[model samples]
Target: MSQVTDQLAQFVVFILDQERFALPVEQARGIERWRTPTRIPGTAAAIMGIINQRGVLLTAVDMRVILGMKPITPTRRSRFLLVHEQIDCAIAVDQVLDMLQLDLSLAEPTPHRGTVASRGLLPTPFGFATWLDLAALLGSINNG
Candidate 1:
C-alpha cells in the first residue's frame, strides 16, 4: 500500500510527559485516564507496574523515565494509554491527545539517540507518527 494511504488510516497520538508523540494508530487498544497500577516487585524501573483491564493483564511503561524525562508524580492530570504491543500494555502518559490523519511526506525518521528503540519517526505538519516497533522497545528494557 502507498505510504499516504497507510498514514491516512487510524493512529494513536499521545503525550509522553510534556512532549507530543504519535505511533501508528493501530497499536493501541484504547486510551483512558490513569489508574493506580499494581506495582510488580523486581521489575525494571521503567516498567512502572501492571494493570488488569477487563480480565486481561496490562503492563504499564513509565514513559517519563523511558524517554529520559523527569519522573512522573501521580496527580489528577495523570493518564494511561492502553497500548497493545506483543501483549496488552498500558503506557502511562500525561494526557491523550486527539487523533488525526498523518501526512507521510512530512514524517521524519526517529533520531538515533533517544531511549526509545525506534526514535526515527516523529509527528509533523500538525500530525506526525512513527511505525510502532514494540519488540525493539521492550527488548531494550533490561529484565535483570
Candidate 2:
C-alpha cells in the first residue's frame, strides 16, 4: 500500500539574490510585477520607497539590502511582495520567484541550517522570520 501525507507551513517562499527564502504568509499580502517606486526621504537604506498597488500605498523594502547584501538597481524584472505586519501595510521584497507551502516537519530553524547559514535571518519550525524590527519598519511610514 502507498502512504499519503499532508504538510503544513505558515510561510511563503520567495527568491532574493538568487536564493530561496521564506516569510510568514500571515503577513504576506501578495506579489506584483516590477514597478518604479517613489523614494522616501530620511529612511533606512533598505527601505526602497512607496509604491501604488491598486491605489494602496505599499512600502517596498529591498530584501537584499535588509539582509545586508548589496542592493540590486531597480530593473524591469524586479517585483514586489506586499506584506503587512503589525501595521496597516508594508512591502517586504524586491522580487518573488514562487509561492511555496513549506512543510514544517521538514523545516528546521534557519540558524540550525548550515546550508543557509549565510542568510542572517532565521526561520521558525513553521517558517522564516525577519529580524527587522516591526516598530522600525512601521516607523518608516508616516502612517502604516
Candidate 3:
C-alpha cells in the first residue's frame, strides 16, 4: 500500500445540523468568518455563489443543502472552510468543532444506499461523524 493508505489522517470536524462531519485536513486551506457570497445565475442550489478571496474567486458551497438538511441562516459560529482538491472552494458550515487525527482502520465504510459523497463514518464519543469525499463533492458541483 502507499504511504497515504498506510497512515492515519487528520480531519477537520464541523457541525452541519445536529450531526458532525469532517473533511481531510490536507485539503483544507483555511477557515474564515462567514461572508456573503455574490450570487451567480444558473448554478446549483448547493452553490452559494462565489466570493472574492484575496483577489481570487472562490465558490462557496452550502453544506446543509448538499447534505439534505434544511437551510439555516448563518449564525455567529458559522464559518467558511476553504478547501482545495482539484478545485478551490469554500464550504459553509454551521460551526467548526475540532480537528482530530483518525486512524483509517477505525473508520467504517459508509452505507452504499446513502449519499455518494460520504467516504466513511468515523465513530466518536458523541456519535458517528461522516467523512466527506471532497473530490466527489466537488465533481458533483462541477458537473451540475
What CA root-mean-square deviation does each model show from the true structure? 3.3, 7.4, 3.0
By lDDT, is 1 or 2 better? 1
Deviation of model 2 at 51, angstroms:
0.9
Q: Output the better candidate (1/3) by TM-score.
A: 3
Positional deviation of residue 72's Cα in model 3 after best superposition, in angstroms: 3.9
Model 2: how far residue 57 lies from native, Å: 1.8
Expressed as tens digits, the lDDT of each residue in 70-127 for candidate 1 is 8778777677777666767777877666766665565567764355555446555444
Stretches of candidate 3 exceeding 4 Å from the true structure: 1-6, 112-115, 142-144
Worst 10 residues of 1 by lDDT: 1-10
**Residue 49 displacement (Å), model 2:** 1.3
Clashing pairs in 3: none
> Which candidate, 1 or 3, would have the higher lDDT against the true structure?
3
The Cα error of candidate 3 at residue 132, in Å, is 0.7
Tens digits of per-residue lDDT for model 3 on 97-127?
8877777788988764234468789875557
